[model samples]
Every structure is written in C-alpha cells, then in structure tokens.
Target: MSDAVVGQVAVDQLLEVLDLKELGPFRFRGVSPRVGPQRVFGGQVAGQALVAAGRTVDPARLVHSLHGYFVRPGDPTEPIEYQVESIRDGRSFSVRRSVALQGGRTIFFMSASFHRQEEGLDHHAPVPPGVPAPDDVPTMADRLARYPDRAGIWAAIPRPIDVRYVGEPGWVAPGDRPPDPHQRVWMRIDGQLPDDPLLHACALTYASDLTLLDSVLSVHGEVWGPGGVVGASLDHALWFHRTFRADEWFLYDCWSPSASGARGLATGRMFTEEGRHVATAVQEGLLRRVGE
Candidate 1:
C-alpha cells in the first residue's frame, strides 16, 4: 500500500534474480524478472555469467576485468544456462570464460580474469572537480514524475539500482540546448549485499551498463521514445582498479569520445564516496533511429 513497502518488495525480487542456482559443478541457471518486456536486459546476463565464472574460481582470486559480447536478445520467458570454462590458473592470476545459452544456442559470452591482491605501485586520477554529491540530486522517479503522461512506462518497471542523475537525463528533451558529450550519475544497489567481493564486482557490472551509452545519445540531443531512437550494446569491457561496494553510492563520470560509422563509443570512471577510483568501463553500441 505504501511506496516504501512496494519499493522494498521490488528490491527483494531483484536480489533473488541475482542469486543464480547451481545445477552442477560448472553450470548455473538464472532467470529474468518478467518486467513487461519481450527480451531480458543485457546487464542481467553479464552479471550472471560473471557469477558463474567466479564460482569456479578460488576465493583467493578477485575478478580484475571482464570482456563480454551480447550475441542475441535474451528470451525473458525461459531460464538461461551458464557454462563456464576454466581457462588457466597461474601462480597469481586465473582466467575463465562463460557462455550463456538458451535453446541450445549461445546468447552471450564473457571472458573474465581474476587476481590475488598484492602490494604494488599505487596511484590514481583524482575525482573530477565540481561534481555534485549524490545526496543533492533528484531521484529518477522525481524527474519522470514531472512529465505525467510519459512517466507510466518508467514507473511500471522495477529498478534494482538507484540512479541519481547529476543533470537532465538524456531521455528528457533538452530544448534549444546544444549536444553535450558528458553524462554523470550516482548509482548504488537497491539493497544491502553480502560481503563477497566477487558479488560486488558482479553488481557493479550490472550497474555499469545502466547509462554509459546514454552519453552517446546526449551528444546528439536524442532521447529514446516512440519513433525517436533505438540502441543496443554490442560489446562491453570493464577494468577494476580498486575495492568498492555496490550498496554504497559511486559516481559514474562518462563521456563520448567518438561516434561514427553508426557506432558510438562511451567510457566511464567509477569513484567511491571517499574519492577512490575503483573501476573504468568502455562500451560501443549500435545507435540508430527507428525505421532508418
């Protein structure tokens, strides 16, 4: 009946979706929430595949990087099977490749590398100047609420991560404004998670895709809507630089360095509340308009 109650329920369901069921030693089963979509979200599959790969590895190794490709749109009506390959185990590093299958066809696959933490040379780029704190921003719901008629679709879906935009969301029309190539948002999981470092990495993987490519659209002043524009991620890569938790708010500063050949590239850096640069990501997507 209350908004808090409804919000809590949605988060509990998201956590359940993240917890994959192991069917065998090297295989896992994951399901997507039936959130009024014919296809499942790509981030969910990536995170699940990473989980499968991490499960096959020893706890001593933490995931430092993963590169994955989206092969096809996932069918939301069925469960996805993840098969992990243990590629190699070195003295200090391990490698694994995970494939997500449905109907006996591979829909997505990823290669992940893990490492045992060790002391080494340490330095990082500082947080960008004049970035507003996450607490001072408006929630997505509040922004969507401003456009009463167009808010229903976004309102009906359940969000596993809370994202606070530093400026206007790219989806909202910015009248008479020139195209901008930068996008910034603060994100955190909807609920608390376990102390597992691998889970944190997977959670960040899921969160990373939320708005990285939107920087591309922002540069063209294109907002996704009926007959407006369409886009899908082709490939994604992430490099973990330091330790961070998914439940705590992290600043994602992103920019579109280039967009040509009908493909746009966007990159992002993740910073912790204490200003530690924890991760970086780059994604290229097929961006085009409807009926083009």
Candidate 2:
C-alpha cells in the first residue's frame, strides 16, 4: 500500500481508538488497536482519559492542563473503562478527574483542568535557532530503512503520526547517535481531522507520549530494547498554551535534565511551524537496562 493510504488507515484506526463509547453518566469505554504490543500504549489511555474528562465539562471550557499517572500495565486484550469525576465547576474554570480501569483494577488516573477562553498577557520562548525545517529532516521510514534489523515490530505497525526526526531516534545502535542533550522532531497526525478544538487537544495528547522519553536516552546515546534500555512511563503532564491543529506540522523540542536511580525526567515544548508555542509536556519514566 502507498504511504498516504497507509497513513489514512492508521489515522482512522487511531480515531476509532480515541472515540470512546459512552457507557453511562461520566463513564466511557475504549479499545486498543487490533495490532499492537501486548501492553496498551500510554498515549492511548491518556488521550482516552482526556476525552472522558472533556465530555463532562462545558463545551465553552477548553482543557488547559492535564496530569496523569500510569499505575499499572494495561492489557491490550481487555477493554478499559474510564470513570470521570466532576471535581469542580467554577465560574471560569472546571476540573475533572478520570480513572482508567481494567478488570476493576486501576491502570491509570488523571486530573484535567479546563477554562473559558479569556484575554491574557502572552509571551513565549522562541523556537531554537539553526534547526532545520520539517521537510529537511529524514522521514521515519528513511531512518528505519538504515537499521532494518532493529526495526522489528515498528516497521510492521501502522504509524498514525508522520514523524521526521531532526537527529537520531532512540532505536539507533549505541554510539551511533552522538550524545545530544536535545531530541527534536517534527510531527503531525497522518490524516486530516475535524475542526473540533477538543478533538485536536485529545489528538495532541496521544501524540505527546510517543517521543518525550526518548530525550533522556538521546542525551546519553542510549537506545531502547535488547542490548540497550527499556522503560515505562511513570507520569505525564501537559499544558496547552494556545490553539493549534494536530493535523498540521509542529515541532517537538525535547530534552532531559536528569536521569538517576533507574528513572528519567524529560520535558518538551510543541511549537507550530510558524513558531507559535502551543503546548508543553513533562514526563518521568522508569528506565533500566535490558534484564536489569
């Protein structure tokens, strides 16, 4: 199949995953992709939880921030039930908490805050200078072609996001990627999306988890899987600063400040191609060498 056709199919599948089924008041259920890892992807859960939270809030209120913790590995074969709590509904702001459960056990929980759009003083950090445009970077397929042995399941899976890495990805061989403190990439949903702002936010939430932790490994020239490091996301947080479409190209500028005791913390900023700083994400994960 052509890349464009594959991208559309992948994106349709992703949308299906994100479109949770409303079971009852403030409760929903979501499913995993038919083909994926044994464990559910963290981004799927986070995005579904956000969707649950967003459903209970006033449409006028837009989600501005979300903080979530991954408590246990999620089974891809089982359905996830998201239970949302209406924490508060103030005059200008609303808060909701969502808990994702499987077999009646909590797998993930999150607190999201929404706000009515209002005028505010605005200033944002500029995009780093000397970074190449999205088109100038190598596509994921191009990079993966160079390391076929390492591609493994990644090559077979459908990718919903078109990612162009500014430098080496985490799957590269040790020492192949020179030690770099930053991991920059340009990405966007592989297909077009509707105009709903909440949908865009939820979409970006799903995309956010894909590469944030790679910054930690990139800083040390470490890779993922056998002969390298393995990790699980412990917690994730995101702050939406402005409006942006998930289907359009955006730069993900990420870096790690510390990694110790088998844990790493990384932060990233998302900016539109026009240099509009739109969002920020922070995550900490448990990282350990294979068989450690």
Candidate 3:
C-alpha cells in the first residue's frame, strides 16, 4: 500500500480515539474509556472541561478566556466528574470555575469567562515577516516519513487537522542547530465542524495544546522524542481575541519565556491567514529529562 493511504488510515484511527461523549454536567466518558499510556491526554480533558463550562453559559455569549490546572493524573478508565462554579454574572461577562474529578480525586481545574460581544479598542502585534506561508509547508504526514522508527507517534496524530511546522524541525533527527525559543506552525481541521461557535471554540482549545509547550524545549537544545523525555502539561490559560473558526487554517506562533526547576513556561498566539489575532495561550509543563 502507498504511504499516503497508510497515513490517511492512521489519522482516521486517531480521530476515533479522541471522539468522546457527554455523560453529565461538565463531564465526559471516552468512547473507549481506557487509560492511555500518558494517564490522560491533557487536550481531551481540556476540551471536555470547556464543554462542561459552556453548558452553563447563555448561548448568546461567547467564551473569551479559560485558565486551568492539571492537579493530578486522571483515571482515563472511569467517567470524569466536572463540577462548575458560577463565579459571577454581569451584564457583559460571566465567569465559571470547573473541577474535573475521577475516583473522587481532583484531576483538573479550570476557570472560564464568557462575554457579550461589544466593540473595543483594537490593536495587536503584527504577524512576523519572512515565515513561509501555510501553503508551502509539508503536512505532518509528510514529516512522519522521516521517522519510520516511531510510527506510533506518527499514527497517534488525528486526521482532521493538518499540522506543519514552519520552524524547529527535529525529534526524529535533531538538526545541525536547535531552533530558537520561538516557533510557528500552520494548522486547520481537515473536515467541517458544526456552526456552533462554542463547539468550535472548544475544539480549538483542544488543538491549542498540540505544540505550544514544545517550543520551550528548544531553549534547552532538546527535541521531543517518543520515549526520551518525561513530559506533561501542568496548566493552560487562553484569552480569546474575537470570533474565529478553528476549522480554518491559522498560524500558531509560539515562544518560551522561561524554564526552571523542572518546569517550563511558554506562550502562543493564533493568527488567521490574513493575520488577525484570534487567541493567545500560555502553558506550563513538567519538563524533566527522563531517566535522570
């Protein structure tokens, strides 16, 4: 069989693994309900947690920011319990706090804010110049061909989104020189998502965790290997800029400001092809070298 056919097959399988079901208030049960090798894929928890928060909001409003922490590794085999706290309700904004629990233990906690649309002062940092356009980049599947040895990680990537790095290409083979603290990538879902703005926002939150944290590794001259480093996201925070669709191609520009004492901090912004700032994110993670 051709590599393209094989690649497509792999992506289909990944999407199945990520597709989960709503079981209760702010809670979800995975389609398979089995613990993945990482205890839990942080993205799944983040996305479902957002869904839980979204349920409590007025549909006319949109979520503008969500801050969360991974308190403990989740038990993927059991249904996660999400507890939402209504922090405040105002004319223009509403706040909610959600706690994800399993085995009666706190696994993740998040605070999200919703907003009624209104005009405001508008300005932003311009999208940097000299970066390759999304159209010119190779898809993740194309990059996977370089690492026949770690086929599992390649296959683990979901099919609906195409990810291509515009900077810092490594992990399979470390480059002659490491990437700078900053990196950029282009991505978009391969299929159409529902028009529900909340759903699209939650989906974007899921994908946001993809490579934003990895940019921090560049500062240490490290590359993410399938088995080399012990890594996990500790917390995530995102501030939405305005209405946007994640199903369309957007450029994610990432940079790490600091890393110390086994933790690394990174920040990123998602921009539309025309360079509108859609959202911004910050993530801190445990970045310990494995077998140290």
Candidate 4:
C-alpha cells in the first residue's frame, strides 16, 4: 500500500484501537493493553483522557502539561467514560480536567493545561548521561525478532512505533544477574506525521505510555511472567517541553527511583536528536509480584 494509504489506515486503526466516544459532558471509550490482561494500560488511559480534554479545548492552544492518577483497574471489556471539566480559560492558557469512569467508578483522573505558542525565557536541564546514538542501537523490532516463536507479551506490543534500546538488559527473560533498574531507549512512529500540531501532540500522548512503567519491572529481575505477577499502571503525568514531531527519533531515557508497597515509580525524558529536551514523563504502577 502507498504511504497515504498506510497513513489513512493508521489513522483509522488508531481511532478503532482507542474507540473514543462522545457522551454528555464526557467522552467514553475502551483502551486495551493488547495483552491478555483484563485491565487497561494506565498510559492508554492518560492518553485517552488527554484526547477527551483536547476535544473540549480551543485549537489555538496546545496541551503543554498534564498530571493524572489511576485510581482503579479498568475492565478492558467495558468502556471507560471520560468526564471533562473546563477548569479555566484564560487569555494565554486553558485547563481541563478529565475523569475516566468504569462500572460507575473513577478509574483514572487527569488535569491538562494548554497554551498558545509564545516566545519567552527558555532553559532546560541538560540531557542525562549514557544514551547511545540512534544509529548504533538495535530497534525494538529487531530485538523482538530474536524471539520469533515466543508469544504473549511480545506479541501484545503494538508495532505502530519503532523503539531502539540504548542499554536494554533482560528484555526477554530474567538474566543470569539481577536486572538493572535504569534503561535508555529511543522511539518514534514508524511513519511520518502531518503538520497539524494537534494530531502530533495526540500521537505523542499515545506513544508516551509505552514501556514507561516496565522499566521498573526490569530492575528486580522480575519478568512480566505470563498470568503471573498481575501488574497495572496506577498514575501517569507528562510535560511537553517544546514543539517536536512525533515521527522523528526521540530518546526515551527511563529509570525507576523506587519500588515498594506493591508499587514502583518510573520516570522518563524525551529528547530530540540535537539533545534538546522535548518532554518528561512519570508513572507509578501496581507491581503485585506473585509469590511475594
């Protein structure tokens, strides 16, 4: 198929995968991990919630920051209701809050802020250390190919995006030694994105949730065993640093600060090729490691 055909198909596929819906004062939909787990992915919830908020905001302003908490596990088979509250509309910025409900209960909640582009003082922390150049690293697709016969989690990962691991260890199974808690990877959509900033931003939101919380799971030599150690995303937040294309290569450097009390925290930063920081993300997940 031609690129246009592929693009069109991708757009439709994303919409179908997200399955967004409109309800009074809210948007409703179902998001799947694509894994067999009965619960939805937290990043999917955050991204979908952003889409819900985006629908209510003006086009002139684009989302720059968001914070969300996943309060309950959402049934993958049931649709999630996203209730959007117009928090504030100002001359320069607007804010919206979204709550994802399932079974008449709040499963996820998010607050997002949008802003019109403006010139102002700009400074960001320098990119962290030890990220491999994109050319030298193996893409996740290449890595997954190493396990062609393996099924389940490997098969569940959606392939709309390309990911290159900077320092990936224990990706397939537990290693001889304990796995490291920190990792670095680069990612982007496999195809080009349109010039529309809104679509690009939404795509970024969709891609941001991938592999975020799993960085924590890698550290403890804990493999995401099939039907074992039930895990779910608990909360996610992201800050857009500047305008950037989601189709271009961006580094996703991830690390886990702590994991305790059945929860683990993972943080990630996205950077452009020239080392400019584009976004930052944080996620906390319920890591109920089976057999304690």
How much lDDT does candidate 2 score? 0.93
Clashing pairs in 2: none
Best by TM-score: 2
Evaluated with lDDT, which candidate comes out highest? Answer: 2
Computed on alpha carbons, the lDDT of every model, listed in order, comes to: 0.85, 0.93, 0.75, 0.73
Question: What are the per-model C-alpha RMSD values against the true structure?
Answer: 2.1, 1.5, 3.2, 4.0
Per-residue alpha-carbon lDDT of candidate 2 for residues 1-292, written as tens digits (9 for 90 to 100): 2233348788888889989999999999999988887799999999999999999999999999999999999999989999999999999999999999999999999999999999989999999899999889998888878887776557776689998889988888886878999999999999988888888999999989999999999989999987899999999999999999999999999999999999999999999999999999999999999998
Candidate 1 lDDT by residue in tens digits, 25-143: 88999999867356777788899999999999999899999999999998989999999999999999999999999999999999999999999999999998898898899987777
| lDDT per residue as tens, model 3, 1-292 | 1133223443344345445456665455443223234466787778777877888789988999999999998765667777777889899998998788887888888999999999889999998778788889976766667555544444553345677888655354455336577878897766666687887787788778888876887666576664445678999999999788877889999889988998889999999888899999999999867676
Query: Which residue runs of candidate 1 sit more than 4 Å off their true CA positions?
Result: 1-8, 174-178
The parts of candidate 4 lying over 4 Å away from their true place are 1-12, 24-37, 148-151, 169-171, 176-178, 226-230
Native-referenced Cα lDDT, model 3: 0.75
User: What shift in Å separates residue 63 of candidate 4 from its native position after superposition?
Assistant: 0.9
- Give RMSD (Å) of candidate 2 vs. truth: 1.5
lDDT by residue (tens digit), candidate 4, 45-96:
7778888888888888989999988788778777777889999999999999
